[model samples]
Target: MISMFDSDVVSAELLADIVSVSKATLLKWEKSGRLIPSQNSITHRKEYKVSQLIQFEEVRNMINSNWDQELNVKPAKDFSSVELFAGAGGLALGLEKAGFNAVALNELDEDACKTLQGNHSQWNVIQGDVKNVDFAKFIDVDLVSGGFPCQAFSYAGEKLGFEDTRGTLFFEFSRAVKEIRPKVFLGENVRGLLNHDNGKTLSVIKSIISDLGYTLIEPKVLKALFYRVPQKRERLFFVGIRNDLVKFAKFQWPSPYYRILVLKDALKAGELYATDVPKSEGQSYPNRKREILSYIPQGGYWRDLPDDLQREYMQGSYFLSGGKTGMARRLSWDEPSLTLTCSPAQKQTERCHPEETRPLTIREYARIQTFPDEWHFSGSVSSQYKQIGNAVPVNLAYAVGRSIIALLNSIDAEVDLGSDSLAFNGSFHSRQLTLLNT
Candidate 1:
């Protein structure tokens, strides 16, 4: 990713943003010798010299990013893709921006289908359970993509293959690939899958990818914050090439954008949005809850409330272990928003406005997800929130989409595999792509 990281020094805040971690985690890395800042600034703040930080993988990638060149890339021909589990069109729209045309989109939710149809009348959206849909008709589509829900397999003390994963959403996705036989396919899911079932789940998935006659790229979670998205959302992406094309195709993960966007960019008129977030329907707390939340400051949570209020608000959760940082939480304008959930005001994941004492409005949620203001939703307020919250940030998808396009371009031009042109990751400012979701 071509980001603007020209300075010789990197601040603690900037480094933390680039690495997709908290400042405290940086401190922990320092203590463990995993990361060490070269020196402090004139104001006595921790600062890292970029030259000395190249020992880190993320830093090295950033310093050698080629995001600007990637952005200028275009399709060698009209490329088409079939998207499964196309929730609310976030991924489809992003891929559209990155130069892929949607041949067909499959969605199970009627509302999400309508959202996609209303926004893009030209799209062929098929609404129904994917089990009933056949992909054999859409042949040679170039690419197939899906954000399939992560489900564990029934392990039998043996390695699993394609049929072993029957009855799961992932199987349906694999079935699509089996039928369409696209040159490439992309799968996305929560980062937690990296360790689900103690890593056996991922192991089985690897087996299935191989069984499907594709070569799986080493998957990585890309952080939205580094992709010009103003929310701390992350999604794990898996890109694979058809076995026949594996010898010729080179797939590189997208590099990170230079800057980290925060809540202020999402809600106010700035780089991310052309205007302040438009007022709309949103969830509200009862009088007592609002009163209690008002006591919390921007970036503070229930712990910041008075002791009595904390007991009243947290109830049994108060006695629970772990930080429970999401409780009674108020967002900070200067920082990216906490990962949003299906509902904005759940007791376990309270995301109050940075200044206002209310949950984020539907429009605000869309803004944080980097959905354009004009891309209207087609559901009740609650459904809209769920759709927006569940979406891949449009910008994040766009960034990855660019990299996918680059890979396709390389394959089409029959570019030399020995050249850096097929790098898994090109030069960046040493502070680029790894998305995280909560």
Candidate 2:
């Protein structure tokens, strides 16, 4: 049983047990000003008060809650979206901001589905494998969007079709688009997809979309930092229009925000928030690792450490050729953080705090990904971290959502104007020049 004491001072070990954190992390929090110790009225020794712990419920509850923040801004237009492979609710929330209602969302992870439902009970979340669900039942969606994993297709013939691309997640995603036949579709993936299988993978994807009677746009990679997310994330975007309507409308991607946001904007009450990041459950480094990282300066990496510590931290990889940028790295408050991974403390891609020697907490991870403060996550500490890291940054998804809305609006306008006015043939360039000159 836990004891509730009043005005009594407790040691770091006691605080660690109460908060379920390590002593090293509690010490680091003290140094970073996140958690300060109170002086005992009589003893004059540093100790944490029980009242202080109770005041941080926002952080404590985050261990098992999903975030749900209302959008403060107004929407430019109204549209509807059908999302596939929805993980956590980053993309869904973003699309909501662009004035689109999520008619349906499909996700395989049960916890992620719970997170989505916990926040937005009205959302139609299909919790199962995409292969088991039939997308044909969902009709009249203005747009179909997903961040499908990139997979290499077996090239048995010159062209890949829906039947030839079996046993791959991409096949399921494409089949949904073919069945629903929405006015427009959007697909996203890691930037490496551009060069996967020597570019054959992307080529096959384009061919499949074309065969489904859609006009594929030249895919481009969008940098998240440019779109108001405080992370240097890059994702490949592929947009397509139903071929019948392609000649009638043109689409443009969203423009970058005026300024790039940094870590300070994400975690604290500044440009991106109204208050400091709430305290929450977080992972901690071992004693030895914590002491070694203490010497690393903000915005510095392994090179900033002493000669011996550098080689020790890097191990045999120290002699390797690549930049090894993530090793022993500390983030800078003024710059976007590196792309987050499933595990915050992994040696290969450490996302240490800007001012502390520890990794970012669960709440900090959510904030950097643009999740609202109220959104709660369920599961163990490690599982929560994995869900947050795997999600798309909400702001980045909102930017893409705005572009989808614009395209849908154009399609609606074209349809209202009648087919004759929007018709385009081989003489499109000459006709456009004539209209401009006239």
Candidate 2, residues 91-157, lDDT tens digits: the string is: 8888887788889999998889989999999999999999998888887577888899877897741
Best by lDDT: 1
lDDT of 1: 0.84
Runs in model 1 with CA error above 4 Å?
Answer: 1-17, 20-24, 28-60, 156-160, 415-438
lDDT of each: 0.84, 0.79
Per-residue lDDT tens digits for candidate 1, residues 1-438, read 223454667777667766667888989988997766766535456777666667767777655667677789788888999999999989998999999999999999999999999999999999999999999999889899989998888774236578888899988999999999888898899989999999988888888888888889999999887788888787999999887666668777888665567899899997877888898888989998899999998788989989999999999988989889888999987678999999988888889998889999999999999999999998898899999999999999999888888888877666333334436555431222121000
Instruction: Provide the RMSD of all predictions against the true structure, rounded to 1 decimal.
Output: 8.4, 14.3
Number of the top-ranking candidate, with TM-score as the measure:
1
TM-score of each: 0.87, 0.78
The lDDT, on a scale of 0 to 1, for candidate 2 is 0.79
